[model samples]
Structures are given as C-alpha cells and as structure tokens.
Target: MASSLTKDSAAPGTPGSEKTFFGHPRGLATLFMTEMWERFSYYGMKALLPLYLVAPGGLHLNAATATAVYSVYVSLVYLLALPGGWFGDRVWGPRKTVAVAGTVIMLGHLTLALPSSGTFFAGLGLVAIGSGLLKANISTMVGHLYDGPDDPRRDGGFTVFYMGINLGAFAAPLVIGTIGETVDWHLGFALAALGMALGLGQFLIGSRNLAPRSTVVPTPLSAAERATTLRKALIWAGVAAVFYTVVGVSGSYTLNWLLVPLTLAGVVIPVMVLARMKRDKELDGTEQSKLSAYIWFFVAAAVFWMIYDQGGSTLSIFAEASAENSVLGWEFPVSWYQSVNPVLIMALAPVFAWFWLALNKRGNEPSTIVKFSSGLVLVGASFFVFLAPLSIAEGGHKAAAMWLVAIYFVQTVGELTLSPVGLSVTTKMAPAKYASQMMGVWFLAVTAGDATTGLLSIAGVDLNKMGIVALEAALAAVAGVAIYMYRNKVKSLMGDVH
Candidate 1:
C-alpha cells in the first residue's frame, strides 16, 4: 500500500514544480498570506459579534439569542461552501470565485459598520454567502499546489497554511476586539473591512503565483448545458428570495427556525454525498474504499469540531460572565480570550509539522485516523480540565483566566492534529473531478459541528460544569477508542492513502 502511494512529478515550469518558499511551492506563500488576512477579518468580526449583540449600543440581544445567532451565522459560513465549491468546480474557477467572494465579504463588513439592525443582519447574510464561496475553494486551491496523493510535503504544506490562518486569527481579536470593546463596535467592523480589502489586494497582486490548475474549470459545461444550469440556479434563487421575504415580513422569524434546517442539512448532506459517490460509476474500487474511510474521518472531525467551536460562543459567554477579566492589572476584553487558541496555534503548528515529518521519515507516523482519534481525546480532556477549576469555584464567582487559557491550549493541540490533516486527506481521497465539491463536503462536517455548538449554547449547556463537560469528554473518549480499535480496518479501506 505504501509503495502504491509514491510521489508523482509535477510538470516543468508549473507552480507545483517550484519550491521557492520553505521547500514547498512558492504559491503556498500567496495562499498563506491571503488566508491569513481573510481569517483576520473573519475572526476579528466574530470576536465582536457576541459582545456587540448584548451591548446596549449594539443589538441589545440576550445571551441565548446572541449565541443562537452566532451559531447560525457561523454554520452558514461553512454551509454555503457547498455551492461555492460547485461554482468554482463547474463555473468560475477558484481564483475568480475567491476574488468575487472577497469583495462581497468586504461589503458585508462595511454594512456591519452601519448602526442599524436591518443592516446588521443583512451584513451577516452577505458575509455568510461570501465565506461559503471563498473558504472551501481557497482550500481546494491549496491542495492543487501539490502534485499527487503521495506528496510527503502535502500535510506539512497544509500545516504551514493553517499557521497563516492562525496568524490572522491571533492578531484580529487583539486589534479589533480592543476597538470594539473599548471604543466603538462599528469601528471594529470597519477595521475588519480594511483587513479584507488589504487581503484582496495582496491576493490579486500575487495571483500569478497560483498553480495553473487552480484556475482550471473542472468538468466544464457546454454552452447549452451552462444555459440550463443558469436557468435552474435562477429558479432556486427566486424561491429563496420568496422564502426570505415572507419570513422577514412576518416578523416572527428567529434563529431557531434557521438552526433546525441547517442542522438537518449538516447531517443529511454528508449522507447523501457519500451515497452518491458510492453509486458513481466514475469511481474505482480503491477510490470507493478511500471514500468510505473518509466518512469515518468526517464523523470524527464533526464530533471534535462541535466541542472545539464553543470557543466563540459558550466560551465567550464564560469569559464574559465567569472568567476573571483582569490580567496583570490590565482589564482585557472578553473577546481577547478568543485569540488564545490562535496564538497557541501559531506557536505550535511548526513543531507539530516537524514532529509528523520526522515520524514519517522513520516510517513510524501514525495513520491519519489515529491522529484524528488522538485529537478527539485531547479536546475531550480540555473540557475535563475546565471542569477541574469550575468544580471548586463558588456559584456566581469568576474562575481564573488561566483556566480558559489552558483549555484553549489543549484544544489547539487537538486542532493541529485533526484539522490540517483532515484538509490534506480530503484532497488525497476525493475523485479528481469532484475535488472542489469534495472540499465543500469536508467543510460540511465543520458545519454540522458548528450547528451543534449553537444548539448546545442555546440550551445553556456549560462547558465549565461537570454535567456537560463530563458528557462531552466521555463521548470523545469513546469515539477515540472506537476509531483506534477499527484503525486497521480503516487503513485497509484507505488502500494506499495511509
């Protein structure tokens, strides 16, 4: 199986063949910086959302409603990746889709800077739509920079790329959170807009560094077929418009209504995708086996993310209400706590990358599934660690800030193990024609977990408490063990992918 997965050559004079940046493709630097700035905008805005919603000068929503809204907003950001990927794969290609989406995202931030409820929700909608377009396709483009399934550098590339993502995430909360929390919320949003604009400019300037394959439209449709596709898309657009208009006019709409359907879609869409792939005549036996194994990875990722994603919602609430706000005589904003994971990720990603590469050199690297299982266990342990401090704190008393920091640190470790590897594996396993679309499917796992995060937050499940924390820890532990027990079977199903 290992022999079957040997690296293949990239064509000469292509981006994939060049190793101009840290021994990886030069294009990686371009994608890295692009993602960094995009994440800066995205996380910066997110850090402000929960606080802004409950602020007197902002939306004035309650905790439950705000968390619910946050969940829905984040879920949609990933959910929209499905169509975004399809559009890139079949229509505009990754480069153009990212450009258009970046513009739309900037507009969304601008709209958010306005002090009107209508504009606020509308801005969230636009951002969600834009993110759906950019997120998966950008990742797909990163995967394209590698030559084949056996590229030893593939995981390392994604790890480095993930570092770029965290670079943005690390700075965003400190800058934007300070402004939003200490100065004006709208100004913070404007800063986010500026970040996106700068990212767009950089991406455009460096567009030439991208792989030629990143801009190729896979399975391009003929003119007549395209016309038919456009007609169907417009019809769906009309239907969506009518539905939204009715809901808006009724004034009875709530985040719960949105959450129900989104959650269902998260579960159902993956099942449908797997079913279709299984039945596809285009996939070979090995491809089918790899896809089957991917489902296990997908489930593990979803479970891990559901717990980890509380960083922005439930964890935010904890920081605001239950965690000590003062650090070394400075009263840090609760939103700043959101930066902890990113900061740790930036510090730790390179170490993790080197660790994996060293192990691979010794032919002793854990299978992808093993790494994923280990991630789940670590994340579950994070909850238990949180419980240790909370269990002793008196009711209505704030816990130490270090407790939350420790939790974020542990969770960051889990993330390093699972997230980038998941991205790399998705690229390795997906059928070539459905590459972008499959990236969207990978994001759907995150969507499911994010939607679940919203549900738990709305239900007032506390991560700091014994009940919920214990439950999550137990579930993650069990899942990890189950996956480990089945590791051999999964590897066999993966054929040469391990």
Candidate 2:
C-alpha cells in the first residue's frame, strides 16, 4: 500500500518544464517562507508563554495552572481550524483566509506585548483563533501545489515545506527565548509581532506565485444560502460575545473557565464532523470507507500529539526546575530546549525524505499504519528515556540537560515518521468537495491531544515526572498495538489509496 502511494505520488511531470526552487513549483518557495515566518511568530510566543505565565514579573501562576493555560491555548489554536477550513472551502478561499488570519495573529502578539493580564489572555485567544485559520489551510495549499496524487514530488514537497516549519521553530526559542527569559517577556512578544509582520509582507508579495486553483472556492453558496449562513454566524458571534462579556465583568476570566469549554469542543467537533460526513448523500461507499480509516488515523495522531506536546508544558517546566541548565561555562535559558526538536527536524528531514524515496523505489516501504505505530512506540520510548534520569537522581538532584535533549531527539524521529506523512495522507484520503474541511478535521486530533495535555496539567502531572512518563508510555503502547492489529483492515478500506 505504501509503495503504491509512493509510485502514484512520484509520477513524472512534463519533461520540458523548468525547475524553480529545488525542482518544485515556484509557489512552494513562497509558501515555505511564509509558513516559516508564521511559525517564527507562533513558536516565538509559544516558547515563552508558559514561562511567562509563571515568571516572577508576569502572572506568577503555579506550574500546574500555567500548563493548564498553555494546553487550552494550544488546543484552541488547532480546534478553531474547523471554522477556518470551512470558510476557506466555502467562502473566501485559502489565500484570503490566510491573509486575514495573519493580520489577526500579528495583532494577537501585539496584545501580548501589553502588560495587563486582561490583554494577555485576550492575546492568547486571538492567536489561537488566527492559528486555526492559517495552519490547516496553509497545509492544504501546500498539497494543492501538486497537480494531483500522481505528482511524485508531493511527499517530498511537503517534507521540504516541513523543513520551513522547523526553520521558524528552530530560530524562535533562541531569539525570543533568550530575550524573553533574560530581558523582558513583553519585549519577546513584541519581537513575535515583528516576525508576523515580516511574514504577512512576504505572503502578500509571493502569494501571487500560487496556482489559480488555490483560490477556487470548493462550495459556492447561493445568495439565500449565504444569507442564512451569515445569520447563523452572527448569532454564534453574539452568544460568544455575551459569554466573554459576562466572564470579564464577573472577573472570572481564568484558564479554568476556558478549559471546560475547549475540552468539550475537542470531543464534540470531531463527532459532529463525522456525523455530517456520514449523512452526506453525495459521498459514495469508497469515500465513506476512506473517511472511516481517517478517523482511526486521527485517533492515532491525537495519541502521538498528547505525548509529544508535553515538550511545551511539562517538559519546559522540567527544563526550568529539574534539569541542569549549564553547558560548558554559560547557563542557557530553559526555553532554548524547545528548539531541540526543530533543530533535529531540520538536520534529519532530508534524510527521512531520501529514506522514504529509497523505500518506495525498492517497493519495500511499510504501510502508513506501520509508520504511525512505529512513531507511537518511538515517542513512548522517549518518555521512558526521560524517566530514567529522574529515577536515577537522588536527594532532589537535577538531571543533566543531555537527558531532555535525548528525549527530544527520540521524539523528533517519531515526528518525522508521523507528522508529514499524516499531512500527505489526509490530502490523499479527503473527498474532493470536502478538502479543506477534512484538513480542519485532521487538526481536531491535535485539539484533542492538546486539551488532554491541559487537563493533565491541571491535575499536576508535571510534579511527578516518573508517573507521567509511565502513564504516557503505557497509553502509547496500547494505541500502537491496536493500530498495528487493524492496519490491514484500514488499508483495505483505503481502496486505491495507500
């Protein structure tokens, strides 16, 4: 199945065409740089968020509360992608949706640069909502760059694009983390706003390189339909406004207040999407089967992210509190640890791309399920590796920085197997009319994982590293086994797809 997907993906294009940016469509370079800068802003803020929340001059929240807030923020960032995806598919298209979202995100960073707690929370909300608009659609646009499933460069293109993500992620912590940790948190956020400004500028300039198809609305509604949709949107917005007003007026606008609703949405949205898709008379049996397979893949991805995303929450705290910070002579900022995964990704992505290409040539690549299961196991093992140093340490001794680095290295390998492949597969499996919507549905897995991470944070799991590691390892093992056992059945459902 994997070989078949690869074969179709690698089909040759017109021989006489000129290669523009590393033998890819010229638009790829534009998307790559735009995504890089967006991530620079996103991750720059992300690297500092939890630390800032608990810092002496900032919120001064406890680690558990801080993690809870971080989790909810990150979860919403992905969850809101549902509406963003819908808007792109049905209304504005990816180009306009992304441009608008970028502007919102820049404002979000600027809001964070303010010192008031009210503005801080408001900033988080804006960033989360804006991220939903951009992340999935940008990825959707990346997939569209290829002519079809037959574009052999599809997976490779995504890998290169994934490198752009890592480039921004790699630089953010080093730049923002350093200033935020050493200088001032608000200054770090200001820098994040600056990053987004650069990205928005680049996007406006380079977006024209994209194929005209990228701007095609998949489902254009009639005037009456548009009116009804607008009415419903306004009603929802009014309700949300009232709720927020009440919370603000009551002085109850805390992370705990936000957590419950976001968690519920994480569970509810996927169910609603699945139900809607199942009932759609337009979809045939093959599409239904593929959608069913995608649900399981979604579950697998959620599990992987729940474990992986701890890097920003529990892991960051661990880096600050329990891990040795000194390297050679100078002490490093804890947020710098966030860069380790991206650094590894930048270094190793091309190798994984080549490895997959080689496997495809030999017709020996494992199925997507196998890769996902392996990724789960690798990430699971990372927790155990993280647990080891903590277990060995005695009398409140701090673990060496190398332990966290080792954990991130292992997790990055798992990410390489799962993340880019997941993106490619989602594009492959989605029904034509529901392309952007399905992409949004894919992000719901991250939403669920992130929400779960937040719940765990509120439960104070960070205080017990060994217990958390053990729990994660066990859960990952079970999920991996289940996926492995059902791999063949899922592949069969995928029909002609890998």
Best by TM-score: 2
Runs of candidate 2 with Cα error greater than 4 angstroms are 1-19, 23-26, 140-157, 212-218, 244-254, 279-282, 360-363, 392-394, 431-436, 459-463, 495-498
My TM-score estimates for the predictions, one after another, are 0.87, 0.88
Q: What is the C-alpha local distance difference test score of each model?
A: 0.82, 0.83
Count the clashes in each prediction.
0, 2
Output the worst ten-in-a-row residue range by lDDT, candidate 1: 1-10
Q: How accurate locally is residue 433 in candidate 2, as Cα lDDT from 0 to 100?
A: 71
lDDT of 2 by residue, 116-183 (tens): 88788889988988888897688878877787878777878887888889889999999998999999
Measured by C-alpha RMSD in angstroms, how accurate is candidate 2?
5.4
User: Which whole-number lDDT from 0 to 100 does residue 230 have in model 2?
Assistant: 91
Clashing pairs in 2: 9-152, 10-152
